[model samples]
Target: MNATHTPITAEAVTRVQAHYENVKKLGHWTSDRRFEVRARRGMAVLDLRSPQIPDGDIDVEVDLDHAMVKLLVPQDAHIDHWDLRYTGRGRVKDWTGENGEGRRIRVTGEIRHGEIRVHRGGVATLSAMFSREFVQDVRRARREGTEPTVADPARSS
Candidate 1:
């Protein structure tokens, strides 16, 4: 009798904190399936379109207070923020709240006087481009004599 074995990966969690400032994670960095974000009077941007991300569901726990959190996902990704607990003007801005055939991201935790914005596909790319990391990537690419990973030359001014 042959028994099929399902490989198991360590459930590593990435944490991001922004207090009165902005914190962003972009580009081809290694990613875990779980995340924790804490923002107070600031903003946090997370890019989940990297190739290093593993398959299956993703989990994000957020704690916001008068802050904003942005998620940049792939075109095919599905976002689920129904489990989030919000108060005051806190809200999750996902136009389509239905599940899709792509990867699922389950969001939980609480938001107080803040917002969570979700951007997919072209919008996500545009959002990523409007950041300091994009400029740094362009400069690094120039120094290395390689094309910038985040920006396209044909679309540049």
Candidate 2:
């Protein structure tokens, strides 16, 4: 189980691209205030429930083409994706909408035949649990003979 995880600092511009491949950015990975995601005919998951996230609005610039991108955010997070330009059935599936409080996630960009799904609260936790990364972590823990980070309250060191 060789997983490549990128460390995103508070001042760095984190970018994740998935072209004809699946990309999962989960666990307790730190996140920057701004992100750039490009998904073309592939699947991408960006989990931002880490405590290292800045205390303010988060901006995510997406460029999607026949792809699916899922964002796992904090329960108190308020997502604002109205600024996204859609073409050919591209849309954002957020049931809770924007509640106007907590950390605001501003999404802006163009999508062509793609979708962006937002998971918050318990839904987000479930999404993180039922993932390939989690499976790898569990397997690694069993091999290393130690408690998996998945059992911890926070998925951090």
Candidate 3:
């Protein structure tokens, strides 16, 4: 673990599973998790429906091959898509990682004929991201060093 005091990666980093088929759901990641996923001809969804991350950033790498992945984070999540590489026609739709900032969501990955979609599917309205309250809350959380309100990032079920 890097002790740099950065909430984005302050504590330890956890690597999640790699999917090959079927439908896999990542319930909720409430911490600074280095979520690694590889989906081949399969589907994976980052569904934080009932629960929310609330704070901090998440590091992710998706090795997708002819697969479709949907990232349904909180409407307030700051998606900082740092690295993205694709081959043989890959596409990202409605992904706000390019022009978004809040609780950083650092996403990096490679794909081949795959699609990664990021959407605000939670309770937040379409205009919620631009609200003053949402901005203040995000700033406060970033300043206060908000920790995880859910389970440990390293514990995989």
Candidate 4:
């Protein structure tokens, strides 16, 4: 009989711990399995659902071998008007490598007023670039710093 096994290293454990810590800090966890936050407009809402993540309702996995991360967003959620803005000052080498040859991207999907807007990264490249941008922003914020501001342009003069 032949058997195969995968060993988990200290680094892996640390990564998992860090990921959970970040998720908690991001307000992704709530008292209820799912929580809803009202948007500026009475017509829109932002819902933060949990347990669904552990139940496979949403699959967010990271592959270190491939140096890739994947996130699956549900369709029924009423996420109206989602904008992911990235602004940071960091050495590319700090995140990607010492040579600084990695590309960053950000992609966001929002459904508002019965309309869906999918902002894809790598708009210029054939491949998906949004992932890189999104990952870089998150990692940078966790390591360096982050300034998050919530504003409703529709209500602004």
Candidate 5:
């Protein structure tokens, strides 16, 4: 990944477009500049947004500065049984039980400069998931002896 501080450029636009085309060829229906993906368990919606793209890939400079994911559960859904993990810079700021009702809660946060801060009531579920995925990706790169598209900070040492 490019550094968050970098500005968007035409080269970045080309890269993003290529990635989108590639993914589409593989049969995914992702075409929006911004998209919302619902979790398999119906517990949350992952909102993704980008500022530039010819097709689907996000411009490197157009970082996903904000991702507001909302978790929705049924009346019988068990909040206590749920676990949240947030991996990015934005933090959840407020979680309110609607009208003093117990079955619903709202989660909101802002991401800036690629850092995520989970608000006090925001669950940490997504962060943990992202961290695990990142580690796995690094491990796979090592096993394959392939340089990652993103620069490796450790190698700069």
Candidate 6:
């Protein structure tokens, strides 16, 4: 969205970060992963919840300036906002799992002039947040070219 003249890097497939200043998408399915985001002045959206990694611990590290990082976490994830320094506000809105052996999402990083918000929900709830058009866009991109997409976030695009 920043549209800055930054050559896009090969988007990470699994256990990688969804960086800024590039084209990226989190597919319909996700797995246990560690997503790192680094940006200077743009927004980063990291969706850690997906079909495969429905309920598990996720590692996230974000470094940004004048940018926002929004993470979509699963409802069962127990989030830990550790060692996270930021000039703006960062918060995690979630609840403990019923069985107490639920997922955990650990977020660590530093940010300035922007906020990092972690929102939690179930599979149905998270899926609803995205539109069918979003999935279609990925399919189209794959057909058109090797445009990086989150078709299967676990697999390198």
Best by lDDT: 1
Clashing pairs in 6: 17-36, 27-150
Q: What are the per-model numbers of colliding residue pairs?
A: 0, 0, 0, 6, 20, 2
| Model 1, runs deviating above 4 Å | 1-10, 96-99, 151-157
24: Cα error in model 2, Å: 0.5
Ranking by lDDT: 1, 2, 3, 6, 5, 4
Which residue ranges in model 5 land beyond 4 Å of their true spot?
A: 1-32, 39-130, 148-157
Model 6, residue 38: C-alpha shift (Å): 0.5
Query: How well is each residue in 1-157 modelled by candidate 3, as lDDT tens digits?
Result: 4342235535555444446665534334343355677888887665443234434456678888888877655656666654889889897766444444444566788989998777663332322343444455457657888632222221222
Summing lDDT over every window of 10 consecutive residues in candidate 3, give the lowest-scoring window: 148-157
Residue 70 Cα positional deviation in candidate 4, in Å, after optimal superposition: 16
Query: Taking the tens digit of each residue's C-alpha lDDT, what string does model 5 give over 44-68?
Result: 2221211111232221111223333
Error of 1 at 66 (Å): 0.7
Q: Which consecutive 10 residues in model 1 have the weakest lDDT in total?
A: 1-10
Candidate 4, 50-125: lDDT as tens digits: 2222221111122121111221123222222224222232111111112211111122322122221221222212
Which lDDT tens digits does candidate 6 get at residues 1-157? Answer: 2232123234343433334453233555444356677766666566665556533356677776766666665555566676778676544433332322345666678877666665555442353336454567667877988543343333442
Q: What is the TM-score of each candidate against the true structure?
A: 0.84, 0.81, 0.59, 0.17, 0.24, 0.56
lDDT of 1 by residue, 1-157 (tens): 1132123367888999999999888776546878999999999988877666777777889999999999887767777787999888888886555456677787899999999998877888888888888999989989999777553222332
Q: Which candidate model has the greater lDDT, 4 or 5?
A: 5
Best-to-worst order by TM-score is: 1, 2, 3, 6, 5, 4
Count backbone overlaps in model 6: 2
Provide the overall lDDT of each model, using Cα atoms, as 2-decimal numbers: 0.80, 0.79, 0.57, 0.22, 0.27, 0.55
TM-score of 1: 0.84
